[model samples]
Target: MPIVYSEKEASLQEVVTIQEVDDLLEWLLANTDASIDLAECRHLHLAALQTLASARRKVSAWPQDEAFKGWIKPLLTTGE
Candidate 1:
């Protein structure tokens, strides 16, 4: 399972399947100001990426792995 929706106060970890993207998006919409930590994430499908890109919420951090860090570089730089 992928660590999809995460915040300082709340967290949602589940398989990064197509069906879970909607729930993740909804969670992000509801907690726009929350600081999300995506350090433990494994894989994110295109659906999840789309939802994340469209979301108005702010993520605090990305995974420490170089590949993951590079992938989410734009998001990490854009402050909330």
Candidate 2:
């Protein structure tokens, strides 16, 4: 599953598509302190990224893939 929601974490694995945005947003809103784990994420849709960014969710883990980490890390860190 791309987005796996739990009480404490929202794990993003493999590829996260735009289709997951709505559910992601709902989960984020519902779980205010839920942290996101992107360690296994290979790709993420712009819409999904935007939803996470807009919500200012905390990233619990970053992807191991350097290329994916390079771009996503800044987005998560800079709060932009």
Candidate 3:
């Protein structure tokens, strides 16, 4: 799985596809206090990006890919 969820965090690895968005949202809905770790994320589906933006959780770590991280970090981190 691209996203690994524990009690209070989601670790995003490699690529997070559109198919993972639903489960990702479900997990977010279930755990409003959860933080996200995107240190390993290379890419994220548009839907997944939107879902994460809407969820607006704390980002524990940004992506290792500088360009990717620069693009989405604001969208994900602005409100926090």
Q: Identify the leading candidate in terms of TM-score.
A: 3
Model 2, 1-80: lDDT tens digits are 78888999999999999889889999999999778899989999999988887777778789999998998787777452
Q: Write the per-residue lDDT of candidate 1 for residues 8-69, one digit (tens) a residue.
A: 43343423668777677767777777655666665567787677766644565566677866
Stretches of model 3 off by over 4 angstroms after superposition: none
Please give the CA lDDT of all the candidate structures.
0.60, 0.87, 0.93
Give the backbone clash total of model 3.
Answer: 0
Worst 10 residues of 2 by lDDT: 71-80
Candidate 2's displacement at residue 60, Å, is: 1.1
Best by lDDT: 3
lDDT at position 15, candidate 1: 36
Model 1 earns a TM-score of: 0.67
Residue pairs that clash (backbone atoms under 3 angstroms), model 1: none
User: Any runs in candidate 2 off by more than 4 Å, and if so which?
Assistant: 78-80
lDDT of 3 by residue, 1-80 (tens): 79999989999999999989989999999999989999999999999999999888899999998999899988998564
Clashing pairs in 3: none
TM-score to true structure, per model: 0.67, 0.92, 0.95
